[model samples]
Target: MGDRRALETQLAVVAGFENPQARLEQYPTPPDIAAHVVHFADLQGDVDGRTVVDLGTGTGMLALGAALRGPRRVVGVELDAAALDTARDNERRVGTTTPIHWIRGDATRSPLCVHSDGNSETTVLMNPPFGAQNGRRGADRGFLRTASELADVSYSIHNQGSRQFVESFAADEGGEVTHAFGATLTLDRQFDFHEQETRDLDTEVFRIRWT
Candidate 1:
């Protein structure tokens, strides 16, 4: 609602508030990155007055952040029931009047219902799993495909290693990378396998527009 710094501060309160279960590849998108993504989208004139969908919205950080900017509507799609419960709690705490619809479903199979607002564009924002874990390879692509199919624009965060695959996949789905930036995804030790107190992951943020 205010400046970028204020928004970041608001979103940052959600960090580490509720950690995710590891089987789901559930890591909350850090507040700073979430703020950056939302703010950048706002600056592009894509968020305000638009319908924003947050695919795999772990705890609704991105969805809530986007809602704060006064979108027409916001929907958060998350499969994990636990995460959804937490998200609902967070939404109530923030006390925002902006409508945020939380759906419990698998993002890969989720279908978007576009409510047209006189040419106001739809934007899909996501931080999908990188699929680095066993048996979950190419997970991010599904979100990308779904976003491309439904939204006019998509902003996503992925492992740096997936850069080439993402670009190529976007082109195949009738979209092109309009902008991209890199960041460090600071991951706190959530799983048993994580030995470090925190790990910094090389990540990329992409803004893709459909043709």
Candidate 2:
């Protein structure tokens, strides 16, 4: 119903993880970036009346954005119970009429079944871990895999310099990268290891069509 700025304003109320895990790389997706992705998807005709899934949906930023955009239903999968709790709270704060199902499970190995015939088309939205943490390389790979298995299309955000990896993965999985763009992820230092009060991360977003 609103423009991207309006969506970003709505999502600004979403809460981040109360106790973020370093291993999970649990930084919240910025409201502006979430708005950008959601609005782009909406313009592409992928959101309204679709079954939108947000994998690793920490605090429901992307999921809530989709919910506000008139998705028929939304499913948010996260492994942390506490994050899911916050997501529920954020859902209320966003005040969207769309129904959202928040599930507690690993997004990499999602618990959702593939859509059956006559079911609404599935579209996935995620800001998965960038695998920048120690011993956590290739973290976003699993998210992509899950999207391939469950969605007709997916929009994902990843660390910069990921185009090659993402393109390769999509080709191998029988998916095609239809849209690519760059964005800035601004993070206020939440964890102890951060050297600055705020950090601006260069990031990329990809829209993939899964066969």
Candidate 3:
């Protein structure tokens, strides 16, 4: 509607969707951070005419934010059914005609063949699992690999500790890291294991392009 700042405030008003017991780690990206990522993506590549995809769109913040940028289409790919329902609710709340589509499947293995709409450039935005839990290692790699396959450019979020690993993985997937920045992401306590009501973690946001 207005500037990116104004859109951020509007996004802050929307509800976040979450499921604590998911097999994959579930952390909704903070509204401010989501807005910031989308704003940066807009600057890097004009999101207005591109097809934007949010790979692990937990609550659709990134997808909706891209929608605010007037993208031609915004697709949110998520595995959790509950999360999808919440995302749909969020779409209604936003009250815009932005073409948003929801695809329910694993981010790592979702079939991408049918989405071959010709000529439109694609930009992916995802806040994937950090793989901190047992057996969840390398989860981010799957998201990166898929992004490389489906989009020309991607903005992925990961832990600061995983910077090297992420960079290496992207390079292997024929991606070049064009830009990155450090940020603190706020996580509200949503599980029994969490000791604090809210915690902030050091995180990195990366912008990569398919080489």
Candidate 4:
């Protein structure tokens, strides 16, 4: 509703995961980054009056950000029940009028139907797992695959050096990368293996238009 700063302020109250799962790379998206992405999407005429879906919505950060905007409806698909519970609480705390549909299911194989007719549009937003963990490589690919199948346009975050991978995948899926940008993800130590108290990860965000 307001500027990016105002949106960030509203999202400041959104909480992180209580019991972080290492396998899922469960790190909360920074409020500033979320605000920036949502504001950019809004400016591109992607948020308002569209059905916005946030895949792997950890505590509803991006979903709530879009909700505060003028989206017709929002859907958050997450596999973690605990995370979804926290997301519901966050939604109440944010107190946005836009309705959000929280689905407790795997985001990669989301149970959402495509609504990409000329009259209606679907926008997918997500900060999917970066495939950092061993044996969990190419994790974000599944999320992108889902977006390709279900979204008219999609915005996603990935590791710093994933530009080539993302571009290649998007091209293969009949999508074009319209925009790309860099960001920093500050992650606090939430797992046993983390040696540092906090780590700053260089990341990238991409906006792709599916044809």
Candidate 5:
């Protein structure tokens, strides 16, 4: 293992975070950073009293941040049992009264209506796998399709190159990008996987609105 990888595992240990598992690579964004994203992006939840569903909400960082920012409800959908447990644990640890719910479910197949109130609009924030390998295409496609079905607006994180990767889906779903921005990521050692020690983690944050 690279020194960076070793260092990362150590950090995750110190922070009481789980080791990187399949499709759980992003871990949890630190609270400060998560708050920054919510504030800077101006992503507040339903004022009419509804919820924002966070797909792929590993460790519930995004969901918790939304709660802190005064969402009516913050719901996180995660498939990984370990990640789900960690999220639930964190919610308790924080002792938040914000009505945060962590559901053990697949993000790609979830019904959007199930996660939000009928009167309130829905927004989804997620960081899903890039599907850079050949075998993971099924997972990627299913996730996108499910996301399209579930939310009014979805903000998903992808490698900046994903702009091209998901282009074909626009035709399939009759969807268009409402907004997108490129952001650079600074990673922890756990983020160092495969061969590279330090990769320039550039991402496109897309707002895909359902018509």
Candidate 6:
């Protein structure tokens, strides 16, 4: 599942193969990206066979990681077509019996937000926009609103740069940070392009539940 060539192709797809990578144009998450997965999985407490949702699931990194945790079903919702393609590919290449549903839509506008299919024991793991530069494009306050009504529990990702917004937004979402950790501790996990010496940045992994 962790094939090198497959991951390489995914990276190329994320980089737009032909276009230059720019924060202003397309903001793809770093390679491997294990911290968010760990954070969410931790907040999940004990999924066992519960359903899980992964928002802004680019390349299916977090979604796939959570799937390995034995969720009955895992859905990865992403807005980018390229990212969706890679996500589906990763599910096929890496392998998983945990049903994977990859939806093509922005995290803020979840197509399944209205679902009432009895998967109430659901958990969501999200890595949303940074609220920097064009970060608000397709990502805004609405995302938190949607999540509150959609899942019983969630783990949302935000950088120190957006502390004020995250704090306020979490309050509005009826959720709060159950655990906060430096990205440095997170970078300690497995990754494609992320490892020690990557960054000393700070990010919060908020375990949001009925605030």
Q: How well does each candidate superpose onto the true structure, as a TM-score?
A: 0.95, 0.98, 0.93, 0.98, 0.76, 0.70
| Candidate 1, 1-211: lDDT as tens digits | 4588888888875634366666678987888888889999999987988999999998899999898998888999999887888889888876678999999988998856774558577999999998878888888988998897778999999999677888899999888999999989888888888899999999999999986
lDDT of 3: 0.84
Q: What is candidate 3's lDDT per residue for 58-156, written digit by digit as tens?
A: 779899989988888889999889888999999888876999999998888865542435646888899999888889987898899899898888998
Q: lDDT by residue for model 4 over 45-94, one digit each (tens)?
A: 99998999999998999999999999889999999999999999999999
Residue 162 accuracy (lDDT) in model 4:
94
Which residue pairs in candidate 2 collide? none
Give me the displacement of residue 28 in model 1, in angstroms: 1.1
- Give the per-residue lDDT digits (tens) of candidate 5, residues 69-182: 555677898878877888888777655578877888878777446544456666666767777655665455666777777666666777777776566674568677766777
- After superposition on all CA atoms, how large is the RMSD of candidate 4? 1.0
* Model 2: CA > 4 A from native: none
- Candidate 1 clash pair list: none
Query: What lDDT does the true structure give each of the candidates?
Result: 0.86, 0.94, 0.84, 0.94, 0.62, 0.60
Candidate 2: tens digits of C-alpha lDDT, residues 66-159 = 9999888999999999999999999888888898999999999899995924747999999999999988899999999999999999999999
Indicate the worst ten consecutive residues by lDDT in candidate 4. Answer: 111-120
What stretches of model 6 exceed 4 Å from their correct place?
1-36, 39-46, 114-120, 135-140, 161-164, 185-200
Q: How well does candidate 5 match the true structure in TM-score terms? A: 0.76
lDDT against true structure, model 2: 0.94
lDDT of 3 at 78: 90
Measured with C-alpha atoms, the lDDT of residue 140 in candidate 3 is: 90
Candidate 5, poorest ten consecutive residues by summed lDDT: 1-10
Flag regions of model 4 displaced more than 4 Å. Answer: 117-119
Ranking by lDDT: 4, 2, 1, 3, 5, 6
